[model samples]
Target: MIKVAFVFGFRNENWLGGINYYRNLISAIKSLPDRKIDPVILIGTRGSEDLLRDFPQLEVVKTTLLDRRHPSWFFRKLLYRISGRDIVFEKFLIKNGVSVLSHHHPLGKRARVPVMGWIPDFQHKHLPELFSEIELKSRDKWYGEIASQCSRIIVSSDHARKDLEKYFQVEARRISVLKFVVDYPKDLDLLDRAALEEKFSFEGGYFHLPNQFWQHKNHEIVVDALKILKDKGQKVVVLATGNTVDYRKKDHFNWLCKKIEEAGVADGFRILGVVSYGDLVSLMVHSAAVINPSRFEGWSTTVEEAKTLDKPVILSRIEVHQEQAPKNALYFDPKNASELADCISKALLCDTRGKGGGFPLNDLAVSNNFAQRIAFANEFQEAVLAAAYPQEKVHSPML
Candidate 1:
């Protein structure tokens, strides 16, 4: 079996999306029929045991090398500077017989094993005002290194691939577009929707806005939409849940709170911040519809989750969202509050829930989801193989 290693070090709650991304991707890898690729996670000593438990089927190696606070990481950095190669880490991977490293930062040009660098999006390029000059330069430099040094680059969407080529001038031949598919929990049907709604204090039908309180998420538009609904005597309620902390914009959540207060739509919005994953999924599954007002996205995990459940999504009409093209979806201009308000008003009339408060999938839809999961795994395996054996002619998946 071809062994592929993924570094797991994101422990911060603010990066819950990143954590879930790896979890879903690894789960997809494990679902491959042939099982030709062996997925391994090289986690730090401080890595979450909960995360480790999520990957019971794969090999997990705990090492000090991945821990940022550990001295060995500093030594690895020094070694990279001195010899123009991550010699210590390279030797460690070689010792472990890792054929390729995926979804991590670039090692060095002189490293032995093949590296597949993943750039989720060009958020900094598109929203430069949100980042400091140092951060901008750092991201640009790092992306440049990934494009130049890595054997293959993995991007989430065709939109990101275009951005990578347009800005970094990376050749299309070396880039792979691997659209990830979500694997929902089996117990979704078991969740008591009424109990969850009562626990979360939902009075009636509510729209779910699960995007984090980041500036680019464009939460203000949603607040504006809520205000419009309230003024029209509409008893609409929106339940927002996500990490309230944005390290770049420290006061963003506070500002959103202030905006809600000023707009006089506080009664219409329930900002339940940083909820458990189970609760998040429960909220999504029980809501009238899921909403994503983000001005930009790589490939929205929220959108994917809604699609997996076959739930209706009222999304911002961004390029990537169009590319995602969920079957049961409504599109609106990201900047237009009235348009979103109209969509919300329309969605309130639809009954998406079934018995037990879940949107039950039909047999054909279930089969299609399984097929898509297999396709995701196959495309990911092909990318790994291409990175490991560039000489072989492996057809790149369609953008």
Candidate 2:
């Protein structure tokens, strides 16, 4: 069996999208029918205990020098500069018999094991105004390192693949575009819709934009749209959820709320920051449709979740969003609040066709999505195996 080490670098403080990406990936790997691959999550000092706790079906391994944020991480960096060896990390992998390292960050030069680098996006190149000088420099360094060092690069969308090749000059063959799939709750019908709505204080026909309040997420565009609708005497509500803190701009969320209040639409736009996954799903179930007005995206989890539920989404006209979201998505220019307002006004009036509230669970949809995810997992495994052992002609049963 091919053993792949999926490293957990994020914590609760990070965006839930990163954590959920790994969760979905692990779930896909576990559900594969071939059973020829063994997946393990390697936990570092700043590791996600929640990931291990949430996914009890998988084997969890704890490592000392695995995280970049670890206390001894600096020492390891210093040692690597001097000796050209991440002695502790290399030894840890060798001891655990981990054949490949599947991670988002750059692997050290001394990392003898094969690496499957995960690049979510090259957003910094496109949205330079959104990032500070330090952020841009650090991103450049990391992507440059990843492109040269990694055996295989994993990207979420073809858009990302093109971006990586264009900006970072990475070979197309080295990059694998794996369209991400969401694993929605199977028994969505079992949840109490009324109670959930009451619990979150949401009213009828509210749109769901379940993204963290990062600057690039473009929460301002949504506020601007709400203001436009309100001026026309049309009332529309939005239920926004996810981590509200933006380290790049500390006042981003507060500034957004201030904008909404100034626009006289504070009552219409609700910022229910960081709700539970259950509540988030319930919100989606009861909402008219999902929304993502981000200026840029690698692959939107909001769009994926909406697709899983077969719910409609009003999204930005960004290249990645167009590629990630369904064809019927109500598209709007990120800079044009009037266009989004028009879309929202129309969505509020339209029927969800039994999607809201008492929406029945779709077993076939769930099964088909999971099956597709399993196929993707098989593809990822084959790439990992091939990278880890160049001499061996790796053959997965599913393939």
Candidate 3:
């Protein structure tokens, strides 16, 4: 059994992309060729016991992230280094003869166990303003170190894989993109679009955009573009769904609100504060056209999820979207709203062709079709497990 330990030691729910990626991976790995490959998930205080309800088969081990600011943190790190507190990791790796990690930030420098690190996006490097000054510098340094130490790098899209090659300078061949997998249920009873509109007070012609209100997300540009649409006598209700909550220690959220107020399109633009996962999915499905305004992305899960949901997406003409989205998605200049307005018009005129709501698991799932996803999970883990302990595996016939 290849013992694979996926790290989830951070608060995952808040970071939606990471949460979905790890969840899909662990679930897929559970039904592999060799059930012997035991997968242990290491998580921190963030995730809920509800995750088990979401995916009952997954095995998880909970632990908290060390407080770097705490007085004991420095000493704990030191003790962790010398005493090699990788006891749990070591036992699992040695006993199973291999272990693989599914996240990027290494908890420590122990590389005796082979790791396949996942770098979801390189947004901070491409669009520096989206991140705080200190954060950009810290991320670049950390990614460089993480890239150097890992056995292989996994990315969500070809766009990100190329970014890693350019900025991180990792070999092109070392990076692989599994493509973002969609978790749309097979039996999707899409809600009545009319009913959702009534419930959410979106009876008017509303444009549903579910993206974080980051500068890189280019939310300001979209709101401004909607202004143009309104000026032209187009009463488009731009129903945006995202957490504009004050998560950032900075006043960026306040600035975003200010931008909306400045546009004077507050009446046309409604920022539906954070919605639940299921509701978010339904929002994407029911919307007239899902819009992605991100200036940069490793791969836009919003776009991917929208594509899988089989809804038309009007996304920024960025490399990430071009690389992953089905060619039919309407593209617009990331910086220019006139171009975006043109796209919005064209998108509205276009007919809906795909089944509404559910990962177009049929079209863009790549290698992760239901059965193939499970099969690929085992293959991916076995490669890592075999690489981790090349010596023992050769001695054991069963291996």
Candidate 4:
């Protein structure tokens, strides 16, 4: 079997996009035809254990290097460079028969194994103001080195693939646009909308903004739009849920709250901080519509989740969001609060009368979308197999 190790070493921060992306990926890969490939997740001791609880059936390997900030990280990084691989990590992989390493960061140049590096987006280049000078330099250097070193790079959207080629001069063929796939349970319809609303203390007719409070996510614009609505004597309630911290601007969330209070629209906007996966989905299922007003995205998990559930979404007209083209999405300019205010007002009006939310669930559409995702995953697996054993034809049948 072709054994590919997926390393999960994300920092325990407010953002859940990285975790959600890999979770869906693991789920989709597991559903592929049996005996084609074996996937293993390598994680650290600290922040990763709780995140992977949903994946109890997955094969997990715990290690220290997964924590980049660990006390011994310096020594381990030096060891990797000295020998092209960490001795302990190499041994663990060999004992488990691992052939390839797929991680969010670039692997050491000395390692003989083929790596699939993931660069989610070039947001720092696009929105430089959101990052400090040190972070800007780090992002440029890290992405450039990874593009030059990795056997192949994985991006979430074709827009990202184009950006990689244009800015980093990475070859188009070297990049794979593996758009994310949402893997919802078959019994999603069985969820009681009323119970979900009651559990979250949310009314049935509130717009949902289920995005982290990252600066670039443009939460401020949503609040500004609510101010516009309030001025016009239109009271629209927006329920926002996500991590309430922004590492770049530590006080960004506090600033947003202050703005809401100053605008005298605190009652119109609700901030529901970090919630469980079940509660998050419950909020979505019962909301009037989901909204994403981000200035940039590689591929939005919010849009994917809305599409899977056949719910309405109001998204900012960024290039990547436009590329995603969610089925039931309405677009608006991110900078214009009036445009978004118009969108929210209209969506709520349409949603209140059961016009947009009454569409019958189409199981075939969901299954077809999922099949396309599995096919893409299979193509990626084929590439990994070719790198591991170039002499053999490892192309498996389509799903």
Q: Highest lDDT: which candidate?
A: 1
- Residue-by-residue lDDT tens digits, candidate 1, 181-284: 88765544434677776688766678889988999999999999988988899877888999999899899999999999999988888899987777888788
- Model 2, runs deviating above 4 Å: 45-48, 67-75, 104-106, 185-190, 352-357, 392-399
lDDT of 3 at 236: 64
Give per-residue CA lDDT, model 2, range 1-399, as digits (tens).
768888776767457898778777777777778666688888775675864444537778876676775667777777777876566666677789878878645456647787888889988899999889999999998888888888889989999999888888888767878777877544333357668667876655678889999999999999999888888888878889989899999998888888888988888888889866777877887778889999999999889888877777899999988887574489999999999998987776674543353462477766778777878788777777778787888767773
Worst 10 residues of 1 by lDDT: 351-360
Q: List the residue pairs that clash in candidate 2.
A: 242-274
Which prediction has more favorable TM-score, 2 or 4? 2
What clash count goes with each model? Answer: 0, 1, 2, 0
* Pairs of residues at least 3 apart in sequence or in different chains that clash in candidate 1: none
Instruction: List TM-score per model, in order.
Output: 0.95, 0.93, 0.81, 0.91
Q: Cα RMSD for candidate 1?
A: 2.4
> Model 3, which residues run further than 4 Å from truth?
31-38, 45-47, 51-53, 64-76, 80-98, 107-110, 185-190, 245-249, 351-379, 382-399
In order, the Cα lDDT scores of the candidates are 0.86, 0.79, 0.66, 0.79
Q: List the candidates ranked by lDDT, beginning with the highest.
A: 1, 2, 4, 3
TM-score of 4: 0.91
Backbone clash pairs for candidate 4 read none
lDDT, residue 150, candidate 1: 93
What are the candidates' C-alpha RMSDs?
2.4, 2.3, 4.7, 2.6
Between candidates 1 and 4, the TM-score winner? 1
